[model samples]
Target: MPGIEAGGIAVVLVARSAIAAAPRAEMERLAGQVSGLHEIALATYAFTEQGQPALREVVANLRRRPFREIRLVPLLFPMEASFRAWIGRTLARWQLEWDTEGPAIRIGPGPNASERLTDLVSDLVETAGREKPFMPAEHPATTGSVVAAAHRRVLVCQGGPCNEAGAAAIWGHLRNEQEGQSLRTAGSGMMSATTSCLGPCSLAPVVQVWPEGTVYGGVNEAGIDAIIREHLLGDRPVESLAYPANGRKQALRLRE
Candidate 1:
C-alpha cells in the first residue's frame, strides 16, 4: 500500500510459457533494488501451457493491488505475430471487464533477443568447452524425407481459448486421422502440428491450414472427418466453418 501513490507505475512481465518462473523471480528480485519510485511491483504471466500465473490470473491479482499505472512487458524474443494479437485481445478484454479509472494499463514492446540473447548464447557456448560438434552418432535422414513429402500442413491452436473449448479431443482426433491415412507415396502426405493462441479467442478450437492460410472455427470431433476428407485430401476450404480474415465474429454452427 506504500507504493499506491497517484503517479506510481507497476511493471508486469509477461512470459511465453510456464517454465519462466525462475526468470520472473529473478526479475522481481532485481526490481526491488531500483530507487526513487512511489511503489513498484513485478508480476509475471505466461501465454501457453507449462507456466503458472497466467495472464488472466496476474491481471486479476494486479487489480487488487495499489497502483496508479500498469506497464506490461513481454518476455518473448522477437515477438511473434500470434503473440502480439493475443496480447492485444487480452488487454482489450481486461479494459472491458474491470474499472479503468484505478490504473492506466499500457503494454510495452517485447524484448529484442537478436543481440543480447545471441551474446548470452555465445557466452554459454564458450563456458561449456566446445567439443567435436553438437550432434548424435546416428541421424535419421528419413524423418526429413517424410516431412518434405507432405502436401498439406494443418496447425491446430492449442492456446488458452481452444484448450477451454475442448481442443484436446480435437487434437487427438486429428492425430488419429493422420495416422489412419495411407502415406504410401510422396504426393499423398498430410502433417499436423499444434501451435499457441491464434488470436481468435471467441472462435475456440480453431484450425489453420497452409499454404492457403484458411482458418476454421468451432471445430469438433464430428467436423474432423469432414475437414480431413474435404480440406486436407480434397483440396477445398470448408467455407461454412471458416473464420473471417478480418477477425469479425460470426455465427458458429458446430455439430452436437
Candidate 2:
C-alpha cells in the first residue's frame, strides 16, 4: 500500500551513512507492517561528530520536497550529549528557517523498540509461520516473569536536571490527580514513588515505567495531568505526552 499521506509530516532519520543504513532498512521493513508513517528520509552523517553537513543535506532535500511538517528521529540511543545538543541547535535552525521561509517542521521521538519495532517481529513471524503458525501459548516462558503479577510502582526522577526541569511540580500534580482516585491494573493499585535521574538530561524530567521499563522524556505540567489520567488510570501509554530522545528507537526491556 502507498505510505500514509500525513498531510505535511516527513519522517527524517538522523544517522551516519553506515549505521543508519541498516536501521533505516530495518525501519522500512518494520514500517511496512504498520500504517500511518510520515514520508521518510535518512540523514547522511554520524552522530559522534557534528552533523552540519548531513543536516544541511537533509534540510535542503526537505526544502525541495516541501513537507509542511517534519518529525526527526535521531538514530542514536540513551540521550547522550550528541543527541541532546543536536536537538536544541538543529530544531531552532529548522524553526527559524520555517518562519523565514516556509513549511514548519514538528518533532517527535526516535523509534524505540517498543513503539516502532513490532513491525519487524510481525514480519518475521509472518514469513516463518508458513509451515506452522506461530503461537505464544505453545511456547513456554524462557524465563520467569519480568514483572510481579501484581506490582505497583511510580518512579519519579529527582536528579538535578529533572528537579530543575520542574519534576517537583509534576510529582505534586500526579499525587493530587492520583489521590482519592484509585487505579488498578492486573490486580493492585499503582504505588506512586520517586527515584534518581533517568539520565535523559537533555530532555529533562524523565519518567520511567516499571515492570514495563518504558521511559518518557520532555515532560511538564500539562503532561503530568494527561499521564495520570490516561496511563495511570487506564493502564495505557499516553503517546502524545512523550517527546523524542537520543534515538529514533530503542526498547528498554523489562527483562534481559
Candidate 3:
C-alpha cells in the first residue's frame, strides 16, 4: 500500500466484470502508484448476468466507512455514450434515493484509450508475432449451445424502465441468491435470464417465474428475499407480492 495517499480517500477503479467483482494484483498496485489515493478498489458500471460487483454497492459500503471522499475511476473505455451517461445518472440517483448523506462522491476521468492503450496494444501485437497464442480447446464452439435441463426459469427484466430502476442489481442479486442457495441448473434446476419486459410497467420493476408465469411486482433487494424463500425455494409463492393477487399457477412445471 506504499505511495498511496494516507487520508480517508477511496479510489474506485471501474474495471471489467471479474476484476471489479474482486479487485486485486496489478490493477490495485497501479492505482496506488499512479493516483496515490488513500484507498483503491474496483467496481463495475453495472451488474451482470453472473451477478458481479456493482458500483452502487461499492460506493454504499465506502460511504459507511470513514472516508471523506470517494473517487470512481472507470477502467472500461470505448463504450456507448449512453452507457457512460447512465453511470453518471445512476450515481446521482443513488445520492437522492439513499436517506443518509455521507462522504462526497466524485467521478475521475476515465483512461484515454488511444493515448493510454495504443502502446500496450502495439506491444501485444509485436509480442504475439514471436510468442504463440493460447491453444484453442478441443471441444467444438457449439459445445455449449444445447439448452439447459432446468425445472424453473427466472426472468429479471433489464431493458426499458427496469434498467433505470436498478434492475441490473436486482438481476445480479437474484442470480447470486440462486447460486448461494444451491439452486442451480444441476441442483434445484433454476435458470435465470435477463429479459426486455414482463408487462405491468406501472409495477415499474418486476420479476417473473417461468412456466407458472408468476410475476412479482414492486420488487427490491429486500423483496427478493421473500420471493426466494417462498416461491423459488419453497412450495408457495410470496402471496403479498403476487402481481395480480391470483396469477400463480398451481404447481411448478419442469422439463428434463
Candidate 4:
C-alpha cells in the first residue's frame, strides 16, 4: 500500500532572544533567505518546560515519518550559560536519541553573527552614519604603527573531535568563500585559516575570528557563510553565535 507523508521535514529552532535579548529578527530573516525543508522558532517556549517537549515531539515525529534528514538549529547566543549547559545538554540528549533511531541527524550550524555573518555586518557598518568614523587606530586585526585593521581572520578548529564532526568540510568552504577576495575590498576578511585544537572538546566543530575573539561552535558550511556575510562583511557582530572566554553568562557586546 502506498503511504502518504504527514510532514515535509521537522526542524526545531531553539532561540534565546528572551533571556539574552539578543537579535532574533535578523536570524529569522536569514533563515527565511536560506532554503530549507522546514523551520519552527521556539522563541517563547525556549525558556519554558513546553519547549523541551516540543523539541522531543518534533524529533519523534520526524523519526516516525520516513525521512532521510532531520535538523536542529540552536539560535541562542553561544556563550549564554543556560544555553551552554542547559540547552547543550538537552540537544545532546536529542542527538543520542536520534542516533539510536538511525536517521541522518544534520545539526544546522550557528550560535548567529558567525564568521561569515560578519561580511553582512561590515556592509551595514559602512552605510551607517553620515560620515564614516576613522577606523580604530588599533583595530583588533592589525598590529604595529599601521594600527591593526581587525581583518576578521576565521580560525576553524580541525582537532580530532571537530574534524570527525565535519570541521574539515566547513573549513574548506570558509577558505573557498574567501579566496582571492580581500576583506577591505569586499569589506570582509583580513585573513581566514583552519587551525588545530580550539580546546573546548564539548563544543567541537568550532570557528573563531578576531577583534572580539568571537567563537562559533556547531558550525558548518552555511554557518561559515553566515559569519562571513553578516559579521565579517557587515558592521554588526553576530552576538548570538559567540563563545566567550568565561563560562559565565553576560550581556553580549556587539563590538569589541
Q: Which ranking of candidates, highest lDDT first?
A: 1, 3, 4, 2
Q: What is the lDDT of residue 101 in candidate 2?
A: 61
TM-scores of all models?
Answer: 0.46, 0.35, 0.68, 0.38
Q: All candidates: CA RMSD in angstroms?
A: 11.2, 18.5, 7.2, 18.6
Clashes of 3: 0
Worst 10 residues of 3 by lDDT: 247-256
On residues 195-229, what C-alpha lDDT tens digit does candidate 1 reach at each position?
Answer: 99987778887998888888889886556777777
lDDT of 3 by residue, 16-80 (tens): 34423244455546655745432443222433324444566777777776666877766656643
lDDT agreement with native, every candidate: 0.65, 0.54, 0.64, 0.55
The TM-score of predicted model 1 comes to 0.46
Q: Candidates sorted by TM-score, descending order? A: 3, 1, 4, 2
lDDT per residue (tens digit) for residues 145-203 in model 4: 65435556668887876766656445555555565344534774467666789877566
Error of 1 at 6 (Å): 5.1
lDDT score at residue 114, model 3, on the 0-100 scale: 49
After superposition, the stretches of candidate 4 with alpha carbons farther than 4 Å from their true spots are 1-150, 180-184, 248-256
Prediction 4 global C-alpha lDDT: 0.55
Worst 10 residues of 1 by lDDT: 42-51
